[model samples]
Target: PYPQHHQQRQEIFFGNGLTANYQARLRYMIARYAHYDHILAWEVFNEIDLTQAADEQLVSWTEAALDFLAEHDPYQRLRTVSWLRERWPEMLALPNLTLLQVHRYIPHLEHVGPSDSDVIAAMLSDVIHLRHAQRPFIFMEVGHHGHDDSDVPGNHLDRSGVALLQKSWAGFLLGGAGTGMSWWWDSWLEDNDLWRLYAPMQRAFSLIQWDDPGLRPMPVDLGSDMRILGWQSSRQALIWPHSRWSSWHNQLLQPGNNPHLGKRFAVTLQSMSPGRRYSQLAIHMRSGAVVAAHTLHADGHGRLQLKLPPYDGSIVLIITPQP
Candidate 1:
């Protein structure tokens, strides 16, 4: 007999009902991966919302998956799912669900046409419903890509995107959404092509991580002397205080700061794994202007507090490996 049937995505088991083959597979996975502690959540599928084939069926499958996890582990595992913002509501109703993950991208201005504030509003509304009612939601993925035209405000878009997302995070703290994730193109920004592009974002989200999740934002006024900027996504966070960089007299064009413009500055370090490598700091300058920048680092760690002042900065703190 079939345990359930949801053929929304190709990942759904072929042939029989949801119970028979799919449930069996689910059990197999849990058993195979004994270290459940490391697993964040059982991501059912990516882009499954776009599949119109078996919407109801998929829901049944999700419910079954949740049941399977609950049966095996008493410590409620987050029944998480990710999809375009349009598909968030369908999964929010599931029992014992942790977060409703929504992926959003701005395809207008830079490229394509039209902005869907309506969609954004609807998504926010759903998040509001979930959070106020004690349910949780997050922007699973939020970022943008370059435009074909010259007027692409890629970094601005990313900065503003997370800023917009923080509005929901504020709501969550006030008992609204749970968490959020800011998406980025690894290659685009890593090469420093998008310095201003994602640096603010990396700094923004880093605050959440640095705060270590317990403390909420406190009210403080630095006036024009300090500027706060950041970037965040579900999996990662980054924050930077622009005042630190801008305070430098003249541009700090030390080596590694800008390889292309000469006097490029580069620092080396290692991380135990990708997860620990949270953020990075580097410097980029243009003639009379100098700025210290920070972004997420996948690997690069192990050292004392960076003494290099005109220090480009490490996105994540470098901790010495224990002997």
Candidate 2:
């Protein structure tokens, strides 16, 4: 629960007289729970930009709070503030802030596209912009706002779930620290029985050794109708691809109009190590099914081209190295 009035909220967080009290509370929290190894990070607020406090005041307070946490927290756990995209420059610049947090709601507006491609594009844009932060960037909230539901004909229970899934995988492939956490998990995911969508993503992530220092996000071009996002290590790479024109809503509402739903394309690999060759490649669908497998070698310049199978949703490719 939050204060009803903006002024009240501002006073509690930014009041001149409350600084000592706030710092004291933070100290107490660290003292009380710092020993519990499970507590990962300390977030100052859920969405502090919504407060009526002036930008300068919020920034100053956040800096002070983060400083206090850094000094007092025994383990020096991560410090972050979930902030609006409008204030990203200010919040992300804070020296003590360790995580770049973001929130987005897909709307039915024409400009927004509200489609799978649009979602991937938006997330890629966000990761690209926040990459300067060089910290763990995450979408703390993602889903369709209920208030905007009137624009659509019926409930988006299934479509929203698929959108969340796509956003999660795309975010990870595009260099996000983790999957976009869906908003209203109780209503949008659990209540709708859509929680199973996460299982495949979890398994996909488990297959990769994320801690490898050689792995880094690499760009790929799949032409206009398709999108590819992935990362490459010294000898191995992981790629994920989805159709730009396909979305759960499009598949459900206008099936007749989408003849190219599962269109296949030959995608060329890029930015590989020169003179190195990949020994094996496997393509996996969202369900973790191995749709295709090949024992292939990269060309002399270190490029490998593969013909993809027909699939409207997302798929993963694991490129293994030579022994």
Candidate 3:
């Protein structure tokens, strides 16, 4: 808990037993960090349920805290609570709340690897309905303990992240949930044994800047063999392999079956219109001894042949459709 004074420093008064000091603390935060764009929203308590508090109590405190803040600074950006899966709806009804976010433990809770798309879709639907048609909701938490000896190393998180992204994008295109964020800030996990396993996923997810026009997803074919690398429907193209720890290769040669190498490279297009400007496609490679970049183009529809050069470490192919 933040020091009572920090909460009171703003003279905050919540109907749920908040002292004036708590409000002061929130005021101090708004006054201090409002200028920074990276701070998404002012997140309230982590898990009110864990504290043995009832939903009504949590909402009352939230109302008081938010009312105090709004009174002092009417333009507070947005508000959210870090909640467990089942309790999200109870929190979304608050009049001043902006979004409903939940932490869902996919395979971990069920003792399995990456959950299926339908399961994710169901959760997303629940989020959409619970908001009372108020604000956009998101999957604020989705992660598994990679270091757990009984668990599979990378497959769970990888598949789950991919599944969630695909389902989320499809939902948004059809108008479902708002946005999402994985558990968070993996830097601290860097030196741990599980870090190496999670590095690829972290890199892949890092490239997604939902706010940036360039990195935004767009529409494209959901090809069968090309391994549904993450795609943003807004961009209308396939997202490249940006993960550093991926199980892929940086070979510059044309993709063909080679038992000696795990790098099986291929690109497929479901449809295209010739003469229309196509996105500039490129591949990035890094070897312990050398670094390289290659660019290619996509012809109208079907599959286009891409020539790759050989390298040691990992390779990422970026498709930038031309306007």
Highest-scoring model, TM-score: 2
Q: Give the lowest summed-lDDT range of ten residues in model 1.
A: 246-255
Ranking by TM-score: 2, 3, 1
- lDDT by residue for model 2 over 116-178, one digit each (tens)? 335676666666777767788777777665554344322354544666776677767878788
Instruction: Give the Cα lDDT of each candidate.
Output: 0.42, 0.69, 0.44
User: Distance from true position, residue 193, model 2, in Å?
Assistant: 3.2
Candidates in order, TM-scores: namely 0.46, 0.85, 0.51
Using lDDT, give the best candidate's number.
2
Point out the higher-scoring one by TM-score: 2 or 3: 2
Model 3, residue 275: what's the lDDT? 31
**Residue range 1-323, candidate 1, lDDT tens digits:** 42344442334442233546667776777777646688667766666556654566666666666666777754556666665545345666777466566565544433533333222333344354554435555666644434433344544443323323333333232232334444454542433353343344333333454434432222212353332223333233222223322221112112233222222223332222343433333322211122433343343333212212333322222221121
Displacement of the residue 276 alpha carbon in candidate 1, Å: 38
